[model samples]
Target: MKLLLDFLPLVLFFGAYKMYGIYVGTAVLMAATVAQMAIIYAIDKKLTTMHKATLALILIFGGLTLFLQDERFIKWKPTVLYTAMAVALAVALWVYRKNFLKMMLGSQLALPDPVWNRLTAAWVLYCLFMAAINGYVAAFFSTDAWANFKLWGYVFPLAFIVGQGIYVARHLSDEAPAEKTE
Candidate 1:
């Protein structure tokens, strides 16, 4: 549900771009993200730091794409986003001496410290790899090609992310009983 909600704007952006052109499509996408941010603020009364950063990137990069009338700007958005995430994760573990994923996921997943460290490393590697792929697609392909990659390429990493989650779950403590809601 959360994923679907978060994805709505991107879907809308793609649909609009396909039907119209970059200017209108970018406008629609920007508005959609703003609406989502509004809802988040309304619901939580305080914007999360990550959410704020994401919104800023969307505005700056997305706005530049529209203003400059260049599709490459928007295409580079993912590279920047993924690279920023990877650097943040890597630096958290290496320099800050903290497990970044734990800060993000530990509340829901009761994994051990070692598991958290390994998972954080995996995420860092994943981000770095995806950043490279995003660059390749955007550089070598047409705008449409890169957009399609953005839309379809999501499934690949997400599938792996889920698989990693399941693998992590296997190591859950035997004493930690499962809770099933009716």
Candidate 2:
């Protein structure tokens, strides 16, 4: 459910692009992101910082794309977002001596400090790679190609997530024994 909600805007953007064009696709993306945020807030009663940041990026980049009549702004959005995440993770882990991934997922996942550090490092590197690839695609590809990449490139993240899950599962402990009813 959560995954679908998170991806709804992107799916809509791709569909709109296929049916209409980039400009109309950008408009649909902007509106869809706004709607997604609103729905998330309604359900969760508050938005996470990540959600707010993503919404801000979508609005800013999407607005510029429409206003300037150039698709470059939207094309660069993922690069900006991925780079920011990489920097934030690196800063939080090294400069501040904080493991943000652990902080965020500690309740659901249990791992040693070293494991958490490794996970954080992995995330930072992954984000950097994603940013670089998106930038390369945007700079070298045609707008139509870039748009297609935007939709198809979801595979990278999905694969990364599955790999991460597999890595984490190896270290995961079995559930605590259930208590017997009186």
| Best by the lDDT measure | 2
Per-residue CA lDDT of model 2 for 1-182, tens digit only, reads 99999889999999999899999999999999999999999998999878888999999999999999999999999999999999999999999999999888876787778888999999999999999999999999998898888888999999999999999888876773233489
Q: Global lDDT for candidate 1?
A: 0.82
Candidate 1 — which pairs collide?
none
Worst 10 contiguous positions by lDDT, candidate 1 = 172-181
Judge candidate 1 at residue 25 and give its lDDT: 75
Sequence-dependent TM-score of model 1: 0.89
Please provide, for model 1 over 64-139, each residue's C-alpha lDDT reduced to its tens digit, 9 standing for 90 to 100. Answer: 9888887777778778888999898889899999887787666667778888898888888888888899999999
Q: Give the TM-scores of the predictions, in the order they appear.
A: 0.89, 0.93
Error of model 2, residue 162, in angstroms = 0.5
For candidate 2, the per-residue lDDT at 5 reads 92
